[model samples]
Target: MVDAAITPPSDVDTLAAGGEHCSAHEATGHHGYAGDAQALQNRLRRIEGQVRGIQRLIDEDTYCIDVLTQVSAVKSALDRVAMLLLEDHLSHCVVGAAEAAATSGDATEVNEKVREAAVAIERLVKS
Candidate 1:
């Protein structure tokens, strides 16, 4: 259960110095998963249920191996979600940046986008 005293950050709270940003949605205000936001939410809801199930298993004194197996399932589900987001980011943000750069005769945005993707990929791999 979440602590009532602990407030989660709002979108404005999470903003950097520049401005507020929605996850997977940058300056253009386009979410990479805009077309499938509901689907994504559903997947996340399922994951949440899985987590609750894990908690119940522990409460019931489930076998160590069984608990670990559920934990692994959760991890894999999360990884799949991450991969989907990454794919959408590549298809939307990176491609959009490249297209815009081509017209503006500037590679800065494209380079930045690529670098961001590389960093995200690295982090995912490390995890």
Candidate 2:
């Protein structure tokens, strides 16, 4: 297996090539569905507020451990958000790409997506 920490040159090239083949198909729609978008936005808003709170905590000279605890919470929350996004991507993007490739008899694109997903999962595990 390839080392997930080190992205291959070909993978970099494929990604840099505008990701055109990968970008053209997605179920989330460019703007995403109303419900999912709104939910994500709300989470982001809460995260933003958390960040502001951290700032205020610093300004008020709050206890170090309390601030660090809040920071850890923020990290965990952000990780949850990332997991959600990854779930969405797999369900919508990866599935659709696989189906399309199967129908077209072109497995290369879908294989790349699978590799990308594997790398992502590895990174998540490491983190």
For model 2, residues 46-98, the per-residue Cα lDDT tens digits are 99999999999999999999999999989888888878877765766566666
Q: After superposition, how far is residue 118 of candidate 1 from its true place, in Å?
A: 0.9
State model 2's lDDT.
0.67
**Candidate 1 Cα deviation (angstroms), residue 50:** 0.3
Residue 51 lDDT (model 1): 100
- Which digits, one per residue and each the tens of the lDDT, describe model 1 over residues 9-112? 23322323333233236556766878888988999999999999999999999999999999999999999999998898788877776676666666665555
Model 2 alpha-carbon drift over 4 Å, by segment:
1-35, 122-127
The numbered model that scores best in lDDT is 1
Single out the weakest 10-residue window by summed lDDT for candidate 2. Answer: 1-10
Evaluate candidate 2 by giving its C-alpha RMSD to the native, one decimal. 5.5
TM-score of each: 0.78, 0.74
